[model samples]
Target chain A: MKLAITTSGETVDAALDSRFGRAPKFLIYDVESGAFTLLDNAQNLQAAQGAGVQAAEHVARAGVDAVITGHCGPKAFRVLSAVGIKVYTTDLPTVAAALAAFKAGSLSQAEGADVEGHW
Target chain B: MIIAIASGKGGTGKTTVAVNLALAWGAPVWLLDCDVEEPNAHLFLRADSAQQEIITVPVPQVDMARCDACGECSRFCVYHAIVAPGTKPLVFRELCHSCGGCARVCPRGAITEVARRIGVIETSEVEGVTLVGGHLDVGVAMSPPLIRAVKARIPHDGVALLDAPPGTSCPVITAIRGADAVVLVTEPTPFGLHDLTLAVQMVGALGLPMGVVVNRVGIGDNRVHAFCAAHHIPVLQEIPDDRRIAEAYSQGIPIVEALPEYRALFRQLAESVTALCAARRFVTQGDGHEHRGGGETELRPLNPATGASTTEGANANVRV
Candidate 1:
């Protein structure tokens, strides 16, 4: 099963990133084979302010079963739910711990953040 | 008469027509700038407003003292304005669209609503024109409430020109809801035509009498006129791209003020608008209660053949 993992850095063990466009990278983890590939998100943020949606889209298009992040905005949460991506929130500093929590079905979804209108 | 001036797209000189018309009428006319998000009518009118009022909307204010963080508000909120699943709920003011659904469903009654001031509407008099406009506080998300506040102050007997927001959105809908007529401004560009269709659909849905005012008429294609012809919507006036008009706008003056020769043109536009209002025939709904409160009354059901079979709740007033 593929997983959309939002991270604060290039490595898998870094903190979960919540800020929309500033997150350095996102790791797409393959749980079944324990394989992973990192996709650079710095360039995508330039085109869209809400990188969370783009990150969600990347994993959803890859047929991911879940999303693990520190925080998710209201719009991104809606998009993720529409695509069948189960959202999980965690204090786990690394992507590996997020996958472990997912395997145990112990991951808690983050509180949905508010997003008024787009100015 | 309340006359709303709208443009299908941005930068179509909707404000220009509204300001000029208000000035030319020379009555106690109220100029409502309903484009709250980026209101620019003030830039042209330059009115020194004395009466200013802040506009607010009711939003859910979660009470932390009332006990459990059951997360019901978060789950129920479609926009996710409240998130208090664990501890006290964090209300993100930017994302709250001011829909009162969260407050109504709160079982604990912890979600009492509070008024949040998002913008200010002011009234001023400039050279005999009563100018009313709104300025959205920076970073405010909502605008419809502010538009409503400004419109409520319109003088009933004079020409009320509403400078509506440029779009087919909720704010635009709120601005033009009860207008007697609408003057749609547009240019003759491909983008202009695309957005004009959207505006036309919106106006048709609202069932309002409308006409077009083509600004900068000779600059682009005649596709706008062609579309109007196809739809049987009349083009009431054509404005040329004059450098003199541009100069006047830069100086924050109405065309009627800067160019005395153009006063007659605006007067004619006002006359045409009044004629349109007179030709409308209003059919009141069958609820038996008068809609306009006081007027010569007439009731015409939508489908006379159905008669009593038609479910009529409120009388529909037909005005030509």
Candidate 2:
């Protein structure tokens, strides 16, 4: 399965960014192959408004099956769910740790937005 | 003539000046409240019957059947209002600027324009003065289009007084642009002085003749007066800090109505504005050339750290 993780850096060991919309980078990891690709989020980070929705659009376009992030806002959550992408919240130190938690079934699926829009 | 009353700081009496001026001017006057975010002119004017019309902007709607989503529309939009990730394009109406560039750029003619309501404009007559105001929908960020709609109702022959929103942003620019003259209302406090300078630069950049009305005098130092004096900008009127005015304002009764004595003062203010407009027209005609470049000198950058003026020749040819 293809999964996207909001991270502060490009590597798997990088710390998870708390902000899904303004994260510095996103790592698209193929769980079976253990390979990953980096998606730069600089444009959405500098967006004047609706950064969460725009970032959600970008991640949805990447064909990810699920998203692992620290928090998801209402607009981003709406867009991700509309594309059938499950959103999971995690406070793990690194992307690899979050992935382990996800595989162990410790992470909880977000029933709705975890934060308000523009948060 | 169109006269825009603007202030860089909020609660500096833009509506107070506008409502009283409309009331004092008697007939053949139109009061346009361009502060769509918080329109308060109607609260004072108390119009009998207001007619409201919805204002909308064109947003792109894609025809999925025509398909080919080559992402042309997404690429053409500068505001990222449309995004085509897969074979389908998604449209975000809130971010759309209604430039119609996406619709024109679509190769298959699949993109169509749809109306999205952003706000409404209301027009009514009160005491012989026509009041036109705009109210933007809550959470809607786009206001310039609605402001333009309110401006369209301005009559050519009568005097049009526009109460612009506070601050020197896009909305304020939209309100004061193309006016015959601009009346900048400000207080004497430091914050008021700081913003007044910015407003002056904006009006100067637009090449419009402007005058100052010092509201709530004696509250701060004379720095604002000094600044205007140094720039040769006319101090059109100085309204004292009176408790009765505030008392009347809180009750939604115009000062001219509560204190009939102030009627003559407002009438004099109106006459001075008219004379200023006439003088500006005479100067423009006498020069035999448009004053297109007169305002460029005042557009220089100011040192924000020191709060010092960097502009030179600010008063050259700016007078009416």
Candidate 3:
């Protein structure tokens, strides 16, 4: 399955960004191919409002089966769920660690938004 | 003449001044309570036979049949009110600024504007004034559309008094825009002075002719008066820090009605505002050009049917 992890930088070794909506960048990893690509979320970071919805939509178009981050807000949660994508909350230090945690099934899927809007 | 009573800080008595001044006018006037978030002017006006009308903003509705999910609307929308993630676009109505840009940009004609209720406007008649109160629905994120709707109720050439919401935000700008003059109410406290300075800068930046009504005097220093004097902004009236006024206010009693002794203050305030407005009109007419203001944020014009732009306020402090 393809997974998207919010990240502070472009490299998988970079720290995992806790924020989902305004993350600086996103690392999309394909477990089967062991290959990953970066989706810059700088635009979403500057969004005056609805950062969550727009960011979620950005990743949804990329066909991310799951999203890993520190917390998810209501609008982002709704958009991700409507696309049948499960949200995984993690405080893992790096993108690689979060991806590994997801592979190990150590991360729990969020039932709803872990945080309120604007979080 | 339209006069907007506003204050940057809350509870400085914008409602008190508005209600009393309208009552003291001694003539039929339109009193529009633009403080939709917490409309309190009606409590003092004691208006009767309130007729409420739900105010709705026109938001774009997409037709999937024609929507190729090109995401044109998504690309055009600055608020991210709508987005298409391959299959179809999802709309977050609360985020929509109702700019009508989406429908205007739809190349396939798949998008059409639809009414989405934001708040309600209650119109009622009091002894000396027609009270128009706007109440924003709970969880409603936008108020300018509803505030505009409330302002639209003002008849042509009618004497209207608007009780603007506290603060120097878009709502306050929306409430006071196009008015001949504004009455900025403040107290003698430091907080009041600080916010009053900001309000003055904001109104002055808008090139709005305004006067100050110092409420709850005798508490703070004379800095407020000095500041007003330094800026040449008139101190229209001052209400002393009287506990009885507070008692009457808490009881929903207008000072003019409950304490007839203070009626003269409001009367003089009304006259001052009238004279200020007349002076401004004279200046504008003499100049042969409407003073468009000192690079103020281009407010969402009085286009009720076409919900105007909220993005302009990013430059609100542009001139200030």
Top lDDT: which candidate number? 3
Mind giving the per-residue lDDT tens digits that candidate 2 earns over B154-230? 88788999999999888898998778888999999999999999888877766667888899887998999988877
Query: Which is the better candidate, 2 or 3, if ranked by lDDT?
Result: 3
Per-residue accuracy of model 1 over B263-315 as CA lDDT, tens digit each: 98888888877765554433333444322321213222212111111233322
- What is the C-alpha lDDT profile of model 3 across B1-320, one tens digit per residue? 99999998999999999998988897888999999998988888775478989999989899989988787898898788887666567888889988998888888999999999998999888886899999999998778888999999888987999999999988899999878888999999899999988887667656667889999999989999988877677889999999999999999999988899998898899889988888777766886955544544333221111112222233345421
- Give candidate 2's fnat, 2 decimals: 0.19
Q: Report the candidate with higher lDDT, 1 versus 3.
A: 3
Per-residue lDDT of candidate 2, residues A5-71 (tens digit): 9998878999989889888888999989999999989998888776887788788888899999999
Q: How close is chain A of candidate 3 to the true chain A, as a TM-score?
A: 0.97
Chain B of candidate 3 versus the native chain B: what TM-score?
0.91
Candidate 3 TM-score, C-alpha based? 0.89
- What is every candidate's alpha-carbon RMSD to the true fold? 9.8, 4.9, 5.5
Candidate 3: give the clashing pairs.
none
Which candidate, 1 or 2, would have the higher lDDT against the true structure?
2
At residue B178, give the lDDT of candidate 3. Answer: 76
What DockQ, on C-alphas, does every prediction get?
Answer: 0.08, 0.39, 0.66
Off by over 4 Å in 1: A1-119, B86-88, B281-320
- For model 2 the local lDDT of residue B87 reads 41
- Residue-pair clashes per candidate, as listed? 19, 0, 0
Q: Give the range where candidate 1 chain A is weakest over 10 consecutive residues by summed lDDT.
A: A110-119
Candidate topping TM-score: 3
- Please, what is the TM-score per model? 0.69, 0.88, 0.89
